[model samples]
Target: MPLSLYLLAVAVFAMGTSEFMLAGLLPAIAPDLDVTVGAAGTLTSAFAIGLVVGAPLTAVLARALPGRWSLLGSLLLFTAAHAAGAVAPDLPVLLATRVVAALAYAGFLAVALTTAAALVPADRKGRALAVLLSGTTAATVAGVPAGAALGSALGWRAVFWAVAALCLPAALGILTGVPARRTPQDAAERPAVRAEFAQLRNPRLMAVMLLAALVNAATFAGFTYLAPVVTGTAGLEESWVPVVLVLFGAGSFTGVTAAGRLSDRHPGPVLATGGALLLLGWPALALLAHRPAALLALVFVQGALSFAVGSTLVTRVLYEAAAAPTLAGACATAALNLGAATGPLAAATTLDTPAGDLGPFWLSTLLALSALLLAAPLHPALRGTGRTDAPG
Candidate 1:
């Protein structure tokens, strides 16, 4: 992997930290901002919605600009948004800042994906993408908890300020580390904007995007509601939440690492086996949520299966849309974020029902099956390296 890829991952780590840490900080933010916890929860939605809208829009807009420049600009925007958010005096202001920060996050990730894929040989695309996505796994492992702890210690605003402070070095590192010069991937440089849009018309690519989205929805639904299952269902102390989450994160890291090595050679088998295991995991989670030992073990196993499948799909999306390299990254980000936003929102509907915490598990099962069903026809498409020169 290139140093630039690691630098991009660092930036991604910063963004990913801000992305979901708000889930833990909501309790602190609600009273300070004078909103109900339910209303304060909209901040997470704002970020998710921003990501869905911003990724493709920003990538399309930045098509003519250098990738490094785009990365720097997004980081600056992200940092500024966080700084403003840290001082926001009202809920609406904080929500707006979240949206703006998410837009920046989407933009940075959109560019980062394509840039990372472009950094290596066609055969190594999956591994390259994994290197980039490892940042998110790392965020789940370390950054999210650290942000939550900081918020608990100082206040929610402290977490915002800390994220802002963290972005500065990442932005600087990216600006200096990412080279401006082009490579083989840039040879077809400057595909017309309309031509890029046309790539979206490809059925296989679009199908892959949808499959990726649905798979993400399943895992995130489970992830979003995990604390409840760990506490209310399994009867664990609230303090154990972070420990369990770390296990999930560690599992995710392992999943992505394994996928990096296997994805290029075995995309079909990886997706099929991972998806099946995840399909089986949700119901088992529902059954075992009461068994602390079983629940902990299941969380780790499910986490591994979830990302092993999710990362491979993301890698597939990038290659399948190689004809529109810039837009591919954005679409991948948009699709994946769309699921991130949707899963939690969907799972939330199941919460107040008799099913309670286990509702997300059932919902995840359905989502996982839907993703598998969608991928059923795309096996031929997923088999190749997806060279840019191939048919669009």
Candidate 2:
């Protein structure tokens, strides 16, 4: 709720926009870089892979850096990467720049969580994380669209330049407005981090994460192929792509806010409800793809459900891993990126068949259903795991 929290969102917005802008720009980039579209597509996976590798690595290495300084440093890296990406002369250089930027992306998120959690009360931690993360969700709506337009009108390079511009101000905000807090250099949060991992290793926690991962895999797998699905299955024109994305983004923005608010009140109900929405929404989305209006509606619902669950899941992780909150937060970001990469690969493989795009959606639906089942059982475990290690 603080202005500082929105400043955190500024960082997330730039990161999210830069990460996803490549998706819309791949068609243009392939020609400019003299590579195949498939080759250009590698940038998305490259960024996610970087995130997966960087999240924990940043956590461990940045252990000695102050959260504020670390965040500022990461933003600087992100800005430099975006600038290099904009001016990249070849495919290899572009890909490398993306990876470099992605490292900053992962580090920024990891430290941002650390910074955000330190600003709020223990019980309010979940809400605090949600507020910070809402920027990412909002990027789905605002940043992605903006990037897509820039890519369409100006050039792919222009999109990167635009993203770079965002970084300077966000850096300034963190440097000025975001109050500094000190944390241990050795990961004093390590014990709590271990405890949180132990909690995740718990059967209930494992089940919940598995469910989330699977559902996530499903949603992304189908989602990765959404444009083709819409074109082939729904008979929609390519021009309608932005419209569809806008619909989903709107849903994401709404869902992220609602989940954050609800989790702050009753995380259990919020998690359970969001999980259930995914279970039902995926099937509806899959079945409805052929009908443009129907598919649009399903996309909206699916976005909301997926993001709502996301908000609740992060909150739950923070609650359960209260002591090692930063590590927990970093792990969550890592897992989500892992899903982003894996889900699309799985969907790409499945959609390669003649069965068309709906198959991935159906698969995602099943995964989401499993997650829904796990949400209720693990809801209580999250509450129990909070603050067990705090000083008496």
Candidate 3:
């Protein structure tokens, strides 16, 4: 991969850390801001709302700019938002900063995906996306835990400061490394607004986007509440939660890497198998929550399956929407964020019921099964040519 792609990864790692580290910091934040844990949890939804609203808007606004400039501008805004968050004195201010940061996060990711695809040959787009997305996995593994520890030691505000500091190097890397011009072919191939809108009318592309949303919803529904589940239901100490998270992140990194290689030639099978694993994994997790050994093993497996499906789903959308790859990339970001926002809100509702913490697992299982059924018609064996948009 190119240095520019790796720089993109650096930027993504900063954003991903901001996105997920809030889960671990919510405990610290709630008390400081005089709010309930449930109220603090809404911060995650706020971030996702920014992503849903910002992706398409940024895609349109940045259409004329080179990828490098667009990415750099987004990072600058992201860093500024995090700086504001670090100093935020109240819940409302902090929540507002999160929305600002996430808007930049969404724009950066959409442009990065488009830029990654532009850098590689058509056949290698899946792998290129995998490389870019690996940064998120890396954040889950390293950044989240580190931020959690820092928050515990100093304060949650310190974590935001740390994220802000990291973005400086990432912005500098992009400025120095990425080219200012799109490749001539990519520039010429850029779609007009009409063509971009036309791609959304394709049923296959829409199905892929829906699948993307379902996959993210299933994963985040359970994942957003994992700390509570680990401490209360899984019978683990609070300290051990971070260790389990590291294992889950490791599995996600491995799964996405493997999926990237397979998705180029066998996206259908990869999606089908990943959905199946998730369907089985969630129920098993719910049933075995009391057994620490089983819970640990299942956490890793669930993370792997969820991310494998996610990577493959993005590849499928890009393929099906080849006429407007950049817009498709932005839509993919929006769809996944919509799921991210919805999943936690649904899980929050479940927590209000008698079912309690276990409710999220069941919710995840149902969503995973839905994704599997939707994927049924996408069998690789039935695909006559390798094209994603072919009629079933």
Candidate 4:
């Protein structure tokens, strides 16, 4: 609702763009660098690994920096990394640059969410977080497509250059728009990070984090290899790949919007229903993958259900954190990156089997169910607590 929230959204849009553009550019980058496609694809994996390592490390190390400062600094780091990637002469150099970019991405998200929480009334926390996350949805709609087009037209490095340009403006915008405030570690602040960690000893928060990771693993397992699935398994033409992906993006946008509204009213129910839907969606969609109409319908529904997980996941993690939401938010981000890295890697290994398409679906189904099952322990803790708060 606030103009500042929209600016934060734009900053996140830039970060998401840089993070996701690699998928489209991998072919171009591989050929240009004289490397195998699989090797070039490791750039994306490198970024995820960096994110997994950086999220908590940065949050802990930068605890003394103002939220506004932390966000701006992280964006600046993102810009620099993009610039480095654009100019790198070798594959190893480019891969290193990606790690830098991902660390910034992971760290910036932690700071951004903390800033969102501090920016509004407690009742609007869900909405504020939604506004921040809309950037990722927007990337699915706008950023990834634009990056793909740019890479196709000008070359993959050009895409990195474009991302760098976007990052500069975003970094500056954040520095200008966000108000200066005391650091989280200031004397005025409540419970330290250690205290937050202690409170996080709760089974509920831990279960939610695991669930979030597993849910993400399930989705990414299918999505990372989607081109193969659609063309080989679903029998769709290669040209249809982009079309289906665009539809998935549209579905993600739809889900994010609806989830934000529902979360404001009933966070637990929305998440519970979404998790169940997502668990059901994998098998249903896999079975229908060969039917054009059914596949299309399932694809859209799966996109919606898969993305809605974040709305509830963020809220639950923060609620469980009580007064020290930063650590919980950071930990959740780390868990998310862990899944992002693991899903594709694990799926790649499994999909090489004789069953091919069936492998990913079965693996994803198991992961999704495991993720949903984590909700059992968390259910009782959430009982009777409102969406914004939980007992410590």
Best by TM-score: 3
Cα error, residue 170 of model 3, in Å, equals 0.7
- In order of lDDT, best first, we have 1, 3, 4, 2
Instruction: Quote model 2's TM-score.
Output: 0.87
The Cα RMSD of model 2 versus the native structure comes to: 3.5
Best by lDDT: 1
- Candidate 1 lDDT, tens digit per residue, 74-107? 9999999999999999999998999999999998
Every model: Cα RMSD to truth = 2.6, 3.5, 2.3, 2.8
Poorest 10 consecutive residues by lDDT, candidate 3: 382-391
Better of 3 and 4 by TM-score: 3
Counting only residues 3 or more apart in sequence or on different chains, how many pairs clash (N, Cα, C under 3 Å) in candidate 1? 0
Q: Considering summed lDDT, which 10 consecutive residues are worst modelled in model 1?
A: 383-392
Cα shift from native, residue 14, model 2 (Å): 0.8
Models ranked on TM-score? 3, 1, 4, 2
lDDT by residue (tens digit), candidate 4, 283-368? 88778777877777887788788778766576666666656666756876776777777776776666557857656666788888
